[model samples]
Target chain A: MAKMTLDQLRKLREEKKGDMVRREVEGKEIQIIVGMGTCGIAAGAKEAFDAIVQTVDENGIASSVVIRQTGCMGLCHVEPTVEVVMPGMPATIYGRVDAEVARQIVRRHVVEKNLVENHIYDRPAVDIVKK
Target chain B: MHFSVSDFLLDLVQNSIEAGARTVTVRVVEDRGLIEASVGDDGKGMDEAVKAKAMDPFWTDGEKHARRRVGLGIPFLVHALRQAGGDWELESAPGSGTLWRFSFPADGVDTPPLGDMAGLALSAMAFDGDYELVMERRAPARGTEWTVRRSELRDAVGELTDAGSLTLARAFLESQEEPLDGIE
Candidate 1:
């Protein structure tokens, strides 16, 4: 197989622009870091990742959520560790994540603008969603 | 905090798990500034089509609507290696297994630095008692290598902690510090 270059991938993505959904970043920009490490993938981070991306697009919540994949966070035990970062707010790392929890993250943190206590990993949490 | 060699290994292991192979072997061999790492699993291997797209960032096989197929882990590492003047390869057979190789300039910033390897080893425990991870490291004249089998840890702990499950969360992290090598 021909190895893919970043430029080639970027071009392919552009050609399929219709299929590409722009995550709403209109509101307060929030960063959702999905641990896509091997362990996280095996544990089903893909499903959870899809749920989060779809929710952000379907809701048209601009400036609402920005998702990206990161390397291992040393919490391999969590398999799927999600770090939610909001401006002026202390980032929270949640473990044992899945699609259901991802929805909760969107509804509660992105919509209702509240933290899902159980999923919040950063202790002594601060207002991570501050504008 | 986001990416590392250990994390890369974990993603390859996912492919192994999907293959239905209960036993997965991971080896990390390093010499001088060169690193050769491979992850192999007895799981169902991918067909030509799947294998072709596996490395495409816009063709994610595991997600419903992933932006690309080249999973972030592979692409990210590829980008990292390229920037560091390194290389990587993916090889697998439908029924045989998958073997991924990543060679990096050990000192390059692009080649992801190794993260808590011990922590990664412990995560293997989470697999169904049948799963296993074999890791090896060689630094030039320093032929000191290491391999950890979930089966062995299960025996040592006297119980399979479902190492990946949330239940063994703390234990999983702690196990990284278990006496595995001369590294205190």
Candidate 2:
């Protein structure tokens, strides 16, 4: 559905370059890691990855968040898993994440400082939701 | 194991990325109902023993957790190719680069589906490294040929590491992929 050319991409990149490339990857405030192994892709991790990318950019937190896709973490059973790590959060990992759930994570968990508790399949068992 | 053709292709390319490859080339050509593909990389090549073992399904590294990595790469690829009545070849050395070439009938009964090509291409481009990935797609029957390069993409999108840049890169890939009517 998208018809992009190098000229168009260059224009779009100019608009985005100044804001997104200001910080190094390790210097970002939040890190979003999506599982993208064969198991994960077959389960639709790419859609989730795209959703997170769009959501973070739309929320104007592109400078603060870094998104990456990693190989299988040996969690093939519950694929399409995503790991979120921020300053005060416990680096929770969510499972069965499609595009919709991915957006909720960025909007609610990353922006509003609330955890998507139900989707979190891995995290320290504690009530760490922001007050 | 039953992923789309693109996914399988991406899996093969991912091995190069994980091996710290600085440049990778992927070529796919479909003409006269035959598909020929190759992935070449300037990554750490395998030695003779390891290279031979890589293609043996029963070979093991003797590590406690070694079961996962074995037979998943070349062995499985050869198995799939055989099932489709195809063949393959791999050439590599410790210092030199690695290249794998294979072919199969496009209409083979077991030819995998070509999944979200944009997604596959994006994922291949976004690996964390100062590298370039060049993908060449050709369809002689349709008189079509196109190439996508990751370095140019990074130059255009600023960087592929973050959400903003990746979203742009993904869109660019989707645009390049004419999925509905063509083999791109």
Tens-digit lDDT track of model 1 for B1-184: 2366766676666556656776777776667677677777777777788877765665566342232223555565566667779877777778887777877777776677765555555444444335565644444444344445565544433333211121232243343334434443
Which parts of model 1 are misplaced by more than 4 Å? A1-131, B62-70, B140-143, B160-184
lDDT of 1 at B165: 21
Residues B14-131, model 2: lDDT tens digits: 7787766889998888887878888899988888898888778666343323345433545667778888898788888876778989888888998765466677778888767788
User: Looking at model 2 chain A, which ten-residue stretch has the lowest summed lDDT?
Assistant: A122-131
TM-score of each: 0.52, 0.81
Candidate 2 residues lying further than 4 Å off, grouped into runs, are: A1-3, A16-28, A121-131, B56-71, B141-144, B179-184
* Model 2 lDDT at residue B131: 85
lDDT of 2 by residue, A6-88 (tens): 88999987877676566334454798998876567768787888899999888878877878888765556677899999987
DockQ of each: 0.04, 0.35
Please list the Cα RMSD from the true structure of every candidate, rounded to 1 decimal place. 17.8, 5.8
TM-score of chain B as predicted in candidate 1: 0.75
Worst 10 residues of 1 chain B by lDDT: B161-170
